[model samples]
Target: MVSGHLFHCRKNSWPPEEYVGRTALQLLDLDGGSPPEQAWRRRLNSHANILKEFSVTFMEAMKMMTLGVRLWSYVREEASHGRKAPIDPFTRERCKPSASQGVPLGGMGSGSISRGFRGEFKNWHIIPGLCENSPVMENQFSIFVSRDSGNKKYSSVLAPGHHEGLKKCNDSGISSWDWNLSGQHSTYHALFPRAWTIYDGEPDPDLKISCRQISPFIPHDYKDSSLPASVFVYTLVNTGRDRAKVSLLMTWANSIGGFSHHSGGHFNEPFIGDDGVSGVLLHHKTAKDNPPVTFSIAACETQNVSVTVLPVFGLSGENHVSAKEMWDTMSKDGHFSRENFNAGCSMPSSSGETLCAAVSASTWVEPHGRCTVAFALAWSSPKVKFQKGCTYNRRYTEFYGTSERSSSINLVHDALTKYRLWEEEIEKWQDPILKDEKLPEWYKFTLFNELYFLVAGGTVWTGQDRTLDLNSPASTSC
Candidate 1:
């Protein structure tokens, strides 16, 4: 159950001096509500930054609701056509909906934003708030929830930035739990943290990895905030398996690049199905986004992963600690061989044109064995109709089952269901939250995230667009 999508982001990774005049998002309702939930909570700051639209006024069974988000993200300091940075915060303005009535944040059932968020939220992005004052970067978006009588439902993916699968961001990124919608049985509450700190100084040497979440039950006033994102049963262990891989890269915002793509696992044998699976790899429109925006690479598990999708300055992660120089530069850009050894990542193809929205997942463990990769993501900001020449390399090798890195029309092959369907919907939402409690298998998958109770007071994710004028473009109008 997946469709077209896109990924590509850079523009210096959206950093306007840590984003000016902050405020981003703040909607409330902690089940104790009545003072207008503390008198109308909607702190989406706006003086001239004029990218406004975050009208979320909580209250669940008690009524009164509203969730808006005009949007943000503009960035344009330099790097133009050759791009790696300098514009593409997801241009075109953003305000499109109708794609068969899909994408209001896309949820329900396994809560599929295609395959991205429904609970335990992660470093999500939805096009820098639709930047106007420009200089944006959002980690999470999509939430509609209404209640004057009942009918509008979309519960997950609220305000969660600070990407890189999160580790730490204290300063008020509150997480004692208090999420909103007046908890009837839970609708939204996020704060998954068994520990924190995602990277800062140098890494002098630190990369074994550990990210736990899958815990959710809520009660105790839902916990309420000391930080650690309130907990969600998540696990990412790699103790001694030599060559480990843990990747989740996202950067979307109004796309349509050659039919966007990125899916996960599918190696069915004994009758030959051939869906090929590999780790993260995406390259489109001349390695854009340092500001050119549009990105994807969620390679989490895939037995000794060996995927490819180069061209962003040909990548210089210094071989990210060298796994054979990142598989010999993705096999000397010829796009690997072994005749597509189990290739898979970026599905959906009918060649209809006009697409971009992507997310990925994969798993294959042994050597130490303890695998878990459940990644999901959905997108749609359509209104597209660009002319744009230079789209990409015409496709090369993104784990080649069909050879492509630039344009199998970019990425989007449609989904049927693979990537182990996010651990089969995390064992059907972690077996009814383990029937309540009985923990002790290293804490039984950890849990919590029906908004997990909410109390967060932090999350803007870098900025700096005094309001632009940077010499011209009509003084950065919008």
Candidate 2:
């Protein structure tokens, strides 16, 4: 006969009955009225019957109940804790990404950038084979609107609660901007290589905005996936009675590891590609002849949309003149003045300083009309160096050649031209799995969420060995 608190029989029974093994757990049902208690009783009885059918002993029941109690406590704490979790739109299931990371920007082994679910781009990893997870204070994406009733402008950063800190906008210009959008007005959904954030509600009852960020991460597409680039496609809908003039602004700081130590400082130049793409290139000059790394921010030109670029701007908001100028230009007409468009400013950063560059795309959306504008961010940092004087070439250099030979403009052109085909390939690969009815919903969610590690884990892929074999079939090789 079993002893102790777990093996006690009911008050009326002197000797143990046939269901004695199962009654050990049922004895734990003390509060019969509470919902949690009732549910726990059902689960405990069900588990006890299964154990009794398998000939489980009283001691086994004690151990299993002990573990189950601890698990139940953890679940209660997580569910009843502060703030509810976000829900997936399709599955209507609770979805919260670990560490607040949404789908990242960039291909595998091509240094990626982490864009938080709140829509801020942080965690700079543009250096070849190096991880820089610090958030650059000046990197921002803003939206400006001009409607008939009034004008509305926002920084577009979304968070759960409103921030309370006082920001001196007069002193720092753009640096003092805060996350003004409330969490209830937006929804962020991440499905690996693609993440969508839908913004609606207060601020503008007639405007609905959705941003889809995509990285070229198709299965078995090594060449495209190895390129360092990401595309942001914004779709704006005007649900109001009047037309709306909307502009999307993207700003990035000239940041690398500062390993180059080149003279004459950093600079940016506007480029109008032969394909009609217009943007600016932020050049990090390392060598006198050729810089080691370059960043390109570009937008696709359409019939009714206008694209503008700010070649150079002060990095800090403390530069009152430059910051206010940038903010005012975007706020006024949803466009940057072309007067300083091509003005090449030499920004000397001897003491760990870097300048900023911006590009804007603006257009008018009629009442109940929809419009889409696409932008791309590309980097050309082919040469990778490590500690102890070791150097290697990234896999992307095999096609684009060395850093000296390739430019970020070439990367931008490739990404913009081929990203549609890449998206098609991604849909083709994922459709079957997503449509399957037998697979559990949680299993499908985990499948794509696991792919985040491919890029955000400080991934590095070196060039393949060229001298392995002749141009023969696979059967010919050993």
Candidate 3:
């Protein structure tokens, strides 16, 4: 124990009677005046109680009037009892998140995807202003690595394994996926429209992966920012002596929201877009004469990287063949087997067989070489329909048109093409605040970080209203 001892000291004191309860006139030192002025002051003091009553209720007035005295007496009493005043009950507790969750994945009024700080994709908020908290088991990002021309292999779902088991054993007999990265070795950084995750080769040990996830959440660039899309750019670094064959896999389910699946015209088909971008389109049959909602998962093919697509696969249970087939293909050579694509191209007939799609971008990284792979997830749910009634086109539809005029493939192309401009605008918006020395360091983070709630917090924005010009006589409405 330390040598110093603690002691308590108390002072027994009280204010003089003249100073205890003084009127405004006495406090203002206005008592000394002529006889007429003294009469006027007296009249004003007489109405002081009425004025106080008008300002506050009787109970509040009494509380305010006696607060100092009550505090003094309470402290003296507590001191006499050899104890300090109790801490405020309100301050004894605070609200905190149950897990490490930050940086949502979409833009304002355009829906969003929520990811935990540990790299697990948690909530899917595709429908405008609605959120699904349950995690989609098949909606994930996995990586595959093969070293020395397939002598050694590594593959995982890029997050910690789930505790829950499969719904049931499928005919192919596969049980679960390889969810295998520990949060201890990985780091996630988030600032509004962009987030970065660094995977430090805990299991693979031969290659390191860094993923930068970007959404067009730029300030003042309303058109691109309002689109429901996000991009994932993976940079792979090979540190070993041998060349490593690497594949970055992105798997997403065809499900958007539970409420939108009542009619059941959901389907998936392969699509090869303009810029060597290839993937599948998830078509949903929505209500009204409006065109169906379409979603796409695609990857860009550069000179060194080749893009592969698995149009349809089962999420889990009763289709273990799909999961096993996918895992085996990725693990063996950092690519899917040719037979895995379009083999099980069938529509969902029941609740158990939920359709999911996968896209893989494969490349070979030389010793001490770096490669980058880019993927985009886009959706075009043009019309927002409520449960009971009323339907309106989304704000982004003003720029890209409604479902009849636009598709998710168009979104994918636009997102991949213009994302650089979004980044530039985002940096322009954030640079000054970040560089300012007058602001506290924490405030810099708090400034942009808190804006996530505006977009991800079930926000809904519709088309602008038609304004009438007041200057012209014809513009004025009766």
Candidate 4:
């Protein structure tokens, strides 16, 4: 037994002050038919009695009725515009009531009744087209639905006519079904294949090493056209206790044409450094006495080439091969020609005229052993030029364990030193001209005249005005 009022106030008195003055009170107030005040008072009293019979406090029962009235009032107001509740304060967005409110559970005595009320309430009060289970709705409804509805008398105060249209709308439709709602469901789709290429030994070995294109002549669609061509080298070393005879096998393929070659086991010779990039080496011959120690093949443009090394002899005839060292030896020895290493191919229009080079390296060494290899790729524009007969100009030259260079200060210092030495020599000689402070006035005037003629490079007469009048008509301007 519960007691509560289910009527709505015309306005929420607790709304912020700014909003309080803005919304019309007429819109907020509930018109619970005529006899509104008396009806409400009587309903409230009846709810209190019901709660008292159930051992509930009168204050608790009043609180329940007030809460019910608050919720129902909000519902009625919202149903008029197909809204369940005002937008949440935190989210600042409207939300729908939960569907569980309208779903009846089995074996629950009041479940059906609760669901019926919830259905009527939701269909009439909540905003149309809103998702009820949305995060925002879950947060808001948790605050709205926990209060008791009070006594049935208070609930009856809600206008039946106002909820009639809402109930009809709820009864007309079923919940929308989505296949993706089930966790077990998945969608199958097709996708492009992503493939990778792997190679043995360094892709770009020493500059001297030569690599000839072996397998696929055309590039693969997945491979970049700008990638430079490369080669894979394999070397084998044999270290066996007894005279051993074995055969070696090799396989290769091109990406476009598929695997192109396979070699049967060929007799192997006992060899030490013979198969390695460096070190003292030895070799042995089979009954055929001739051992095939080294082999090389071209690589296709489409696919990367790979090589594997294995000895045919048992433990007593043990042998090791280093693919990296072999490539390094080949590179350092200039096995790869300049033309092969410098393949200046053109780029596509979409790529523009820019040029690029790519170099990759891989090194392998026996455990507990020292090995070194270098790989490099150098590229440049085809339009670049190399100047011939070029001479270098160095400002400084090393002498006496120090740098000697000529600069402005050095020139000035040397010139001043020479001038001082000359002055000393002149003083030592005590020349009359050097000692004389002044010359005769006639001699000074003659010297001045000679300087003037040398500067002007012509003769002229000066009047009292100190202006010169030239004898030649051509010199008049000067």
Q: Could you tell me every candidate's TM-score relative to the true structure?
A: 0.23, 0.70, 0.71, 0.11
Which 10-residue span in candidate 2 carries the lowest summed lDDT? 33-42
lDDT of each: 0.22, 0.59, 0.59, 0.18
Candidate 2 lDDT by residue in tens digits, 1-478: 1122111112321122212122212321221100110010111011111112124588987877876576556445534753121211222222122334567788877566787665556555554323444455456667777776665444443332232222444544454444456555455556667766556542465677666677889898888888888887777778778788888888876665323322447667777774657788877765433326788888877897888888777635443236557777777667876665566544554544456788898899898777887888888778654322345677788888875324577888777777778778877887788678886554454566567767765566667822111111110100
What is candidate 4's lDDT per residue for 298-385, written digit by digit as tens? 1111112111221221111113122223223232331223232333222211111111111122232222211222111101110101
lDDT of 1 at 78: 28
lDDT for residue 244 in candidate 2, whole number 0-100? 84
Encode model 3's per-residue lDDT on 1-478: one tens digit a residue.
1121011011211113211122211221211100111000111001112111124578886877666566667546645854333311112121112223556776766556676545555455654323455455567788877787656777777765542422445643224556665544555555666766656564477666666778888867777777788887777777789998888888876675443443555667777778887777777665343335677888888899998877776635353337667677677656655454445434642543566678889999999777778888887777665322356677788887776224687888777777767777887887888788886654565566667665555555556722213222112110
Model 4 poorest ten-residue lDDT run: 137-146
Runs in model 4 deviating more than 4 A are: 1-344, 347-355, 376-478
Report each candidate's C-alpha RMSD, comma-separated, in the order given: 22.4, 17.8, 21.8, 46.7
Off by over 4 Å in 3: 1-99, 162-175, 257-264, 285-292, 315-321, 337-349, 404-406, 465-478
lDDT for position 263 in model 3 = 51
Greater-lDDT candidate between 2 and 4: 2
lDDT of 2: 0.59
**Cα deviation in Å at residue 2, candidate 4?**
82
Global CA lDDT computed for model 1: 0.22
Number of the top lDDT candidate: 3
Q: Measured by TM-score, how close is model 2 to the native structure? A: 0.70
TM-score: the better of candidates 1 and 3:
3
